[model samples]
Target: MRLTELPRTTSFRLALMFLALFGTCSLLLFAFVYWQTVGYMRRDQDEFLQRQLTFYSTLSPADRVQRLREHPRNDPGTRRPSGEFAANGQWLVGNLSVLPAELRQAHQPVDFVLPSAGAPVPFRGYATQLPDGHWLAVSQNVHEPREFEALLLRAMLSAGLLTLLFGLAGAVALGASSMRRIDAITLAIRRIVNGALTERLPVQGGSDDLNRLTREVNGMLDDLERLVHEVKGVCDGIAHDLRTPLTRVLGGLERAQRRASTVEEFRDAAARATEEIAALLKTFNALLRISELEAGARRAGFSDVALAQVLADVVDLYQPLAEEKNLTLQLSGTASPTDITLWGDASLLFDACANLIDNAIKFVPAGGHIEVRLDAEHRAISVTDNGPGIPASERKAVLNRFHRNEPSRSTPGNGLGLSLVAVIAHLHDMKIDITDAAPGCRVSLSWSAR
Candidate 1:
């Protein structure tokens, strides 16, 4: 990827955010260290000056003079450490030349300047009033803290520079690695879009967030590829199933136009064409309804549905048709009132069951039997028929729209009954299991309430 594109990636943006946060924390740390250093230095100075004043106040005048004599005398013209001054401002017998004008004759120490040999020095001192109209002052030297501050500042600057450089480099390195992974993901997606349904996003070794996302995306791709194939199959069905019926309609119309001598002959051809058109419309409607149900548009009407009631209703609705064909239609199930109900669209569930029962009635030979069972214990419904059963190999194929088995082609159905059942089951989060029922077929749809 281009350098300019790097910044546009999620990793680079997150790195920039990290850098900002790091800078903020660094500034706060620097401020805290500077404040603490200054406080420590001032505290040490205060304690030293207080001790000197306390010692000076304890001494007798004569002994105090001896102690003042011990103050450093090697540097001539330097300020004294201990001294006595008359109230009239004359230096009595200490190291200082005279009393500092700013040193109040009070117990607390105060800061002042003292003239020395070369440059004037900074000092802090305390003065106490004596019993004999004199002031005893004790002083301590205080070098300028700015010189030490300058040294500390230089050290901090060097360390801070190193930290910034290293942190930024690490951030960039991490961002680059993320970008590489993202690029791989993009390449994989591009290949998929180019008809490579078998392609999948690569998962790196660690189970990081990116890898988890890749795995989820790969799973979605699996479904998408299946749906794409299913759609292709549906398209193929449309071409295969609709073409013959549509051709019949067109051929009837052509025959009516060309070969029919009388109006009655033309009317007969037109009547046959109308029948084919109606069949086409039925198939079309069934496909549309399946799509609509699978899309979940009917879910808004959902409510608690009694499974037993739905099965009973399917039997009643198809009982007459079964009687007309000399077939026995029976509904048998056991359920407590509480256990019989499930959450679903009542109308849709009835329609699905009706379709299943209708298919059984149509497929079973005259005098054959069709059975509908509601298993409340398992949250399932099954329809079984005693006729020509579907082979195990064709069970799955028969669920696709317009897929007619070889023996059932002459039956009057658009071949969408079980396909509609599958769509309804899917919308209701149910599964369909098709199996041979000794003499015929049994198709059961089961639901998981939990």
Candidate 2:
């Protein structure tokens, strides 16, 4: 599936999880708050009742009885704070206080807690009769019972809904922001594949994973782009240089065929053309070999090759040429070096080392010195030459295809020497460095001991 779709679908599942967790937490909090509030209200009402009873107990017993006798009748149902008295309450109060039939049968004073039925519709109350044939009652109207519970449920539902809404909004905002960055990367990749070799992903200067991945992939793309450009330039140069000689050979043969007074002259011209064609074909073959090595298509042929042996072979092959040019060629290292083995195609490695040595001998003046040194500690091999060293600014460029310095333009060699070495190094997961060697240049090839 598309890259954008992957993240989009994952976010949908994450949102559902976020909602469920937040909703559960909210429900628990609502339950806790409601229990504490309602419970405290009930406890406060009970405490008030205790305080009133204490107040009544402080009165003298004789005064309490006199007040009960003198006070007018106060019906339980119609009593108000204004002390309004009922006209015919004597019998109702006497019967209720003196063990009325309902109380005698139940054998207890009437006590109940329930909502009031009138306009107030209070939460709780209690009713009873005093000892002296007088009715007494206590009631509390702190809140409406059903109405309060209904309102609480509505508020909880509203809060839960609002929480879900805000949570989803935040998730969507974060998801969209991240998606924009991914889209930018995707578009950049598409442009690069479509031949925009110079394209690069925008870096926002963060140390996050996405930024690191972008940087690494962009580095790889940079190498690929340079390789492709180099290949293109080499192909163009080959076509230009070979086309001239090929045209001349064809023209000469055509002229010989028309002007031939005998078969020998025509055959001689045909032989010269064939030789030129063979040279051109050889150059093309070499170019193809380098390309194949760079492409890593020969990786399957890799084996554990002794680095010292490879160096010995290359030095042996080039010593004669170096001596003819009046140059010193030396290969000096431990007889049985440690960590001298490398994993790679033996033939390709030999060819690459030969190219480096050949380039070194060609550039160095007569009687100049060349050495192939091995560093066991560093698992590295170096080919050094006493010549006009390459400038630091041009070291990397020289490793690219068809790159030639102006000073070496007169040299009878193609500029694919170090470039091929670099390709081989990359294929073997090794590193190649062209650095200053005091009055000359040193090319190092290093590999992992593991």
Candidate 3:
């Protein structure tokens, strides 16, 4: 967030490290090029000096002196000069007036300086001792090559400076970007911690790694918000639904204590209170079962279960209830009962199927028809009944605890049957769909291929 902190950021530090590494490599490469170029130029100068000395060696002394005198006149610039000298270091011919001390080594190349009219000039030359005890020296001035080397060094330095500047700027930009995103995320998290359940992390809308991580965190926030709301709703539902049964139990006992005149009257009041207490216990048990299923505790008892057989058993268990209400109950499938199977807890599946059948029997009119259908290829089972269908708007709500339709409020239930079914379906990795069967309601549970 601040300029002083930029260098401490990981992005900036990593960029600086790479820049340092690149700069080191560039320096090494430049040094190699400088070494090779200087070496090549000096080699070229040495070869030229050796060739000139060899030519003079093949000549007579008198002709060699003549050629040396003629060499300076052929090129008036005196860039290349040849001189004949005595063994005592006396300059005898050519434009050179003083023999350099570098000529002390016979038949070897050396570098030395000579004075010009304006400044001192550098030269590379070879000296050889003639058979007559005289000396032959040939040289070439190297001022331009030295200047070229200086120019190359300056250019490399300029390029390296510019690269360093640009690299630092890029590192700062990346660090600043990262810092801004982190600040936004921190602010959002603080807001959420302060009870802003809807707050979410910021996203830049790019497919970069940071953006992808932000999106995932936001999705998790969404789920957390939903769960918090569900927990609050469950608490409210528990308080409201349990209060009625408890009040009835208290009221029935109090009436018996106050006005019951005989043992029979007292027994009736006790029976009524017991029935309400039993219903309250049933509701609590159903809640615990749902919680257990949702926590995946039933998964340990999982095994291959014939779903068709479960449906048959459910139909048989609920057939007498349907008959007592003058309703028709039937079970049919697209495949053999033995062949339609699933991987789940058998008792849970049976309870879920039984709940669906019981609901159809309870709600359907007298003489109404109900069918339990199974589709093996699609791994689905459904119950269709000619009853007043659940409205589409309340379908999802009915799967929550203590949720009952207005028409079914007078029925004898705590409204946990479908909620239990939903938890069972979830434990088995199945989806429940409530759809209209034209004139009635159809509830289906399906699972994908494992």
Candidate 4:
């Protein structure tokens, strides 16, 4: 904004550079015009002087002498001076009282100093022999053209100065505006870097390049805020879930050490303690797997995988488990494996779909209906069950680490099945949607090849 800072901006520097280029071009153009104009004026003067001498030479000596008697200098428009003198360099009968020293030995057009103005002046003249054996001289005035040249020079100089002033003012205004915007962006980013997660850059609602950059930066901030919240939730869940199990294990071990007297009593406590420890390890491993998937490394090994085949395999893997639980498991979709092919990591997709089916079978009541449907035409796979469906408010929450609905708390799970499925779906550029299926829930994962 200050004069000292203006020179440091790119806009100001570019303005100055363009102005210099334009000024140089203007100067060269004026110089050329001046030179050509002067040359033309001098040529016209020489022609006028030669014409006067030729016209006078055609006259008789008496007429020539009579013409010389006229005071030619008295006519301002033609300042042509005429003179005749005995070849003795004496005073002549003309407005030019004396011949310039530089012109004494030559008949060419020349310039001489004016004693009245004390300045050099231009004139073109001719010297010729008269019939009386004397010298005759005539000159054409050149001052008018020279005066015109001076006036042109002054006009151009004033206009150039004005143009320079206006251009500089405009450049300064533009540079200041640009610098102010840049300064604002810098300050906003600094605040964000200082842990102000909710802070956002301002958008002017224009399609300028800087506005687009600001929008992109704001988008990144939004993602950062979401990710920070997710991490915080995961940490809190870890501390809360692991603490109870860990305390129970410690209490069981302590009891065995102090009260157990027989080997059978010690064995029972040890088995219970081992089960709690196994659960802790399982929770840790599931968290690690979700982190790995979200980190986006699994997609690197993606290949063409048929969704129908994955569904069938999931149904097969969980059928026996469903039978043991007395739940009716059914696979109803494309019978052929070649119906719908998806571009993704096959193993990851298999695992994700397996979790979905497993989740459905676990929650469904005895003899309840469980179905895996694959829509080859739409490239969608959904798992539905007649279990206590998740509430609309809790559907989204169930996709987070260790987030369990009230109905799922009694089930033997760490609340990471759907979370892992969400991670895998994201890595494959897929979308996971959960909706109420009448008396139960329907979970569907859909995607395109790209």
Q: How well does each candidate superpose onto the true structure, as a TM-score?
A: 0.69, 0.69, 0.82, 0.71
**If both were scored by lDDT, which would come out higher, candidate 2 or candidate 4?**
4
Q: Cα deviation of 223 in candidate 3 (Å)? A: 2.2
Query: Highest lDDT, which number?
Result: 3
Give per-residue CA lDDT, model 3, range 28-107, as digits (tens): 88788878988898888888888888998899988988998888788698888888889898989986667788866645
lDDT of 2 by residue, 333-360 (tens): 7546745788888888888889889989
Candidate 2's C-alpha runs over 4 A off are: 1-21, 32-162, 179-196, 207-217, 244-275, 334-339, 406-409
Tell me the tens digit of each residue's lDDT in model 4 across 108-213.
7676544545566666666776667677777766677778878888877877887788779878887887788888888888999999989998788688988999
Backbone clashes in model 4: 0
Off by over 4 Å in 3: 25-82, 92-99, 102-122, 207-209, 323-341, 359-373, 381-395, 405-408, 432-444
Q: In what order do the candidates fall by lDDT, top score first?
A: 3, 4, 1, 2
Model 1 per-residue lDDT tens digits across residues 1-450: 566677777777888788879877887798789779977987877787678777877888788777777664743545437778888878877676668877754457777787768787877777877788788877767655645866777777777787788877877777788888888889988998898999999898988999999899889998798678778777877786789789888888887888889989988998898898888898999989998997889888878887877777778888999999999998887556336777788888898889888888777889999989888778788999998989899998888777778643777777788889899999889999988899999999998876
Candidate 1 yields a Cα-based lDDT of: 0.81
**Considering TM-score, which of the candidate structures 3 and 4 is the better prediction for this target?**
3
Model 2, backbone clash pairs (residues 3+ apart or across chains), number: 0
The candidate scoring highest on TM-score is 3
lDDT of 3 at 214: 89
Instruction: Give the per-residue Cα lDDT of candidate 1 at 439.
Output: 91
**Model 1: which ten-residue window has the lowest total lDDT?**
71-80
Of 2 and 3, the candidate ahead on lDDT is 3
